[model samples]
Target chain A: MITPITETDLLLFYYQEADEVTTSIIREHLPENTDWQYFLNELATISSESSSLMCSPSNTTLSIILEESRSQLEHTL
Target chain B: MNAPIIADGVLIQRYMQGNQAAFETLLNRHRNRIFTSIYLLVNDRYLAEDIFQETFIKIINNIQAGKYNHEDKFLPWAMRIARNLSIDTIRSRKRMPVVVDSEGRDVFDCLGISVQSREDEQINQDEISALKHWIRELPEEQREVLILRNYAELSFKEIAVLTNTNINTCIGRMHYAILNLRKKMQKNTVRVK
Candidate 1:
């Protein structure tokens, strides 16, 4: 049986430090029914979808914060 | 009017010179990454917004007061503020019983992730939510490393500096985090099946 990929191996793969052969082996052996697949999928890209998981504060809220924060900064400085 | 593309340092310099547009550009550029990092840490929407505002307020005031450094490295500086504020909020909230279950899609630790388009994402919502649940359940150190690496997109070296720890320690924490998460997810899978 192929050895299960360790945490270190997964991290190496995540960071693109793993050689192609190792990652390919991992991809082949890693079960599709695990959260590992989910995480790898989620983190595989640097897109806004991955970021939405991190909680994207709305643009309206951000705009208000920016405006109010500038006012506070102006008053303080 | 089209805003001239400027370096982060130039943006800061212009903002310091009372150019509101420059400051807006800078804030717009970095808000999502920085705010998302803060939210993942605190796990509260209003609190995250408060800390985000306070962080930018600090940044703007500091620059105006001539106390800001790290020119052109705006995100890290903003991120440091967000991190500090988040830590303070968490520390102060010691005993707040409620934990956010991956966007409150569930009442408790169980969360449902809605599948959405994200640069060719392939994971289903259930798996993604399970991953989120496991992530939030990880120890704070490990979770912080995960958020920095995954959400903030920070390099390990940058994380080490921000967390004020060694690289090996940070890496080790991330390894343990992922391992522990995998272990839990497997258990969850078995329970469901």
Candidate 2:
């Protein structure tokens, strides 16, 4: 009997980090239609929200100051 | 910031030569990944920003001090700094319960996030929000591995090296985390039914 594909197995597959043996096993055990892919799809879909947090310091300001401050910080060397 | 595209090796060389624009280019490229990695863990915008800034500052200090050996990609090195700072903040706060201000309002909510992404605009809004929320609710060990893997895009091997654990342990933590999110989704579906 095929061992069940654990969520960790799916996670590794979703990240494309799973080995061939694990991938083949999961693929073998993958439910006919919507089971595994649904969770993985939902995960990949919302991964972008992590970046949605407000851009405090604003990207422009951060870009300028990060380098400008680095230039000045070089003076301390 | 208008600097041309250059490899990280080239950029580091330029920065070492005191060409600041190269530094800006490097920061611009990886800032979001680094910022998001830290923010997802901290769940506190202000603290995350502080960690982000400190991460960059530490990189610059190490670079200038002749210490930063770019054995791996520049982003991972910078991310390591961000992760350490964020975890340090968490450790310090672990002893004291999160306290509300005298007004009994969440003082943290004052520093709201600003640049939310529209990449997943096509997805179901409520489902995506719930999934994201559940991921945040995961235990720290599991959540850190997920954030490092998914958001930061670190390999299990890289995560093991960074977190100083065995690769199997990292994978195990990720397993439990995804399982936790899946169960939460199932529970939500059941409630709806």
Candidate 3:
């Protein structure tokens, strides 16, 4: 049986931000681990799906505030 | 009349120079991300909206009063205000914090994954589905870490700064989170078998 994948190794793989050497090692050894495929799929879904949720705030509210701020500034000036 | 928005620092400088249009432009650029983060924290739509408005109000009033500093990074500064206000609201209400990562998905604790039989695709899919369910059940801290790290694409450094914790602690939290999740999965698998 292959050695258990370290959390760090898996993390590097899942993030896919790891260096080439580490990634190559993970790629080379991944097939030996039955669970790696499931992990890979989950990572793919998570990286893609979760990213959309992480963007900064909406522009509508900001526009409203901006309009109001502009109006108030105009009136004052 | 459509054009790219200016940088946050440049916008702040213009606003400080009494340029309302510049300020408005900056607000438009950041509102969604700011509001979404606030909403995620409070978990109440109305409260989140209120806090979102209040945060901008603070920024505007501070700017007008010559109290808002442009040198400080705008995004984190705004987020700090929103986060503090949301945390205060949660505390005052004495409500246990509820994290909603998905629109309609079930919560599952993502501790450690189970030892799955790789030869069975059906079994693997079932295990994965079960894992998703468990991730939803994890505690707020663990769930947030998993979501922020795995989903938010935030660097460990960013998460550490945001959470006011060290990287090792964040990693440990993640480790425990996965361990707990894996244990739960193993138990469930055994039971189902």
Candidate 3: DockQ? 0.23
Candidate structures ordered by lDDT, highest first: 2, 1, 3
Instruction: Specify the highest-DockQ model's number.
Output: 2
| DockQ of each two-chain model | 0.21, 0.25, 0.23
Worst 10 contiguous positions by lDDT, candidate 2 chain B: B113-122
Runs off by more than 4 Å, candidate 3:
A1-5, A9-38, A51-64, A71-77, B1-6, B63-72, B95-137, B146-154, B174-193
Candidate 2 per-residue C-alpha lDDT over B1-193 given as tens digits, one digit per residue, 9 for 90 to 100: 7956689878887788878777778787777777778877886555676778778878877877768786777767777888888888988867655446788855544433221222223223324455556877899899999888877778898899899999999999987886676578667764211
Best by lDDT: 2
TM-score-better candidate, 1 vs 2: 2
lDDT of 1 by residue, B1-193 (tens): 9967788888888777667788888888777778878876876656777888888878877887788785437777778888999998888767556656556643443433321222114334223445555666889999998888877777777788999999778889987876676577567654211
Tell me the interface RMSD of every candidate, in Å: 4.9, 4.8, 6.3
Model 3 lDDT tens row, B62-167? 7667676767667767766776787788787675443444664223223222111221332354333444445556776776566556643455656677789897
Relative to the unseen true structure, what is the C-alpha lDDT of residue B189 in candidate 3, on a scale of 0 to 100? Answer: 47
Kindly provide the TM-score of model 2 when superposed on the true structure, using C-alpha atoms.
0.72
Compared to the true structure, candidate 1 yields what TM-score?
0.66
The chain A TM-scores for the candidates, taken one by one, are 0.41, 0.54, 0.48
- Per-prediction TM-score, please? 0.66, 0.72, 0.58
Can you write out model 3's per-residue Cα lDDT over A10-74, one digit (the tens) per residue? 76567665567778777897887667776665456544543344434445565667666776566
